[model samples]
Target: MPYVEVLAPQVPNQRKAALAKSVTDGLMTAFGVTADTVTLYFLPISPDDYAHAGEFEPQGAGQRILLKVHAFRRTEAERRAAAIALTRGVCSAYGVPGDDVAVYFLDRDRSEVAHDSKLASD
Candidate 1:
């Protein structure tokens, strides 16, 4: 399974559903996971809560989206491909510039993740 967390301040509510679908599809394709095995979470933040370069973001800070992906360990090449897929999916879904979307991947062992009161390794 793979978990994707998206934090953004500029994403419009009307498009969130589409964005989620895009993210799920990208993850499934990139990691060869089933749709039900991929989890997508969106956390919307206010400008007052987000900052860059040690300054609070202004009203027009631009369309910025941050993605954090957690999954099983993989080769560097695989991780790189997944990141590209995620970035393209987000940018295409939200109509944001590619540079405004960033994707970070974290590889974890099965023992490090838990679901439904049980660890993945269990």
Candidate 2:
């Protein structure tokens, strides 16, 4: 399976969505699949969204993380497992510590995806 992430500082929601679409397109092109079949997850957070070192400090200097996951399963448990694995992979890939990265798995069902929409639902 292939997934992607955009780890950056706090940005506008439009930028966040655009990044999601771009990464989803990249994943589709990389995996020889259609964008409709891919689910791009954007985990946008501010410096206050998490707690660091037992204090409400910035994580990795307030680095925002976007996690994209591809999971095929018949049950919720398997889906979550795949998601967790994907999060771990993204964390490792960006050299962002697992404890520092905030993971958000955006699940886009094929039904909710539309031609002119990045995602009908978050």
Candidate 3:
């Protein structure tokens, strides 16, 4: 199963829901996995939850978006690309202009995450 988690400052109820649904659909299509088997998580974090560290982010606190996705079955590179693309899609869907967004992906073998615990490979 593919696990996805997204974090961003609070947005309109309808917009947030639509963004989540759009992401879920994109992942299902990109990973060639069943829609039911994917576990998508969304977390909205305020300015306190973020810290800007680069030249572009050289300013006080502001709204930001973080997206992390973990999946079994694909290589790390593949997963990362998919995650980045999804983040871009989300940015466009939400009409986020000049916003900060980041996406990351973690890959592991299917056996790593079992029903209740991490397996030996983990």
Best by lDDT: 1
Per-model TM values vs. the true structure:
0.84, 0.41, 0.73
Q: Summarize candidate 2's per-residue lDDT along 10-117 as a digit string, tens digits.
A: 556665565555555545443455766665544555555655457676554644465545432225654455445544544544555665445454455655555576
Which stretches of candidate 3 lie above 4 Å from their native place?
54-62, 97-99, 116-122
Residue pairs in candidate 2 whose N, alpha carbon or C atoms collide under 3 angstroms: none
Root mean square deviation (Cα) for candidate 3: 3.9
**Top candidate (TM-score):** 1
Query: Which lDDT value does model 1 have at 43?
Result: 84
By TM-score rank, best first, the candidates go 1, 3, 2
State the weakest 10-residue window (summed lDDT) of model 3. Answer: 54-63
